[model samples]
Target: MRRPRPKRGERRIDAATDHLAQYGFAKPQIRNVIHDLLQLYGRDGWVFLEEGSYPMVLNRLLEEQAQQDQDEDGSTITDE
Candidate 1:
């Protein structure tokens, strides 16, 4: 017997996982992130992923993380 086909949501998850993995996210974390994004954006998240804007989302997430890390490290200077 062959495996059953995945539904649209499942396919979306799979695609998102693959794309996110390229950005160094682990499978488990990717799933959780996607779930959270879905909850946060609602239907708009699905449209964003379908339109290939998820990569942009991931990039922004990474940039934020880097900024946070930099701030924590006190490498970011504040001008008086």
Candidate 2:
């Protein structure tokens, strides 16, 4: 049997999957982030980000979150 076509919203998600996976986001986390983004921006405004800005913005946010997590837990996270 052939696979069904992915929805429009999923196109944006599929585009981001590899990038997010490289940053250690599992499927659930990626979905949660997408959901949060949708909630933050509202449906009409929730277009996929520009390619040039996406990675930079996402990296900064992830770094900020990592710092906050480390600060709260008082643990040192070494980068590989």
Candidate 3:
């Protein structure tokens, strides 16, 4: 079944944060990063999944986290 649409503003932000929680990155920081990302695209508008920008950004964030882990000698990764 199709999922219900997210409400604009707070609900959408919360949903985005919740989605990000599935990752090892810091949730609050990632939320801020997501906000900045959305703002960046707001002027140009977003693209569909067939476009590479969305996945590229996500992969870049994961790569950044990996870099941070290496910088910390691999001790900062989240367990859950």
What is the C-alpha lDDT profile of model 2 across 42-76, one tens digit per residue? 77533454356455337645876788798999988
Per-candidate TM-score against the hidden true structure: 0.57, 0.51, 0.50
Ranking by TM-score: 1, 2, 3
Model 2 segments beyond 4 Å from truth? Answer: 1-10, 46-53, 56-68, 71-80
**Model 1 backbone overlap count:** 0
Which ranges in model 1 have alpha carbons more than 4 Å from their true place?
1-10, 71-80
How high is the CA lDDT of each candidate model? 0.73, 0.64, 0.60
Candidate 1 residue pairs in backbone clash: none
> Comparing 1 and 3 by TM-score, which wins?
1
Q: Which is superior by lDDT, 1 or 2?
A: 1
Choose the strongest candidate by TM-score.
1
Tens digit of per-residue lDDT, candidate 3, span 1-80: 99888666546456545655676657676666666666767734334311553454466578777787788895565888
Query: What lDDT would candidate 1 get against the real structure?
Result: 0.73
| Candidate 1 lDDT score at position 9 | 55
What are the per-model C-alpha RMSD values against the true structure? 5.2, 7.9, 9.4
Candidate 1 lDDT, 1-80, residue by residue in tens: 99899886568788877777887877676777677778888966788755754865586567667887998998976799
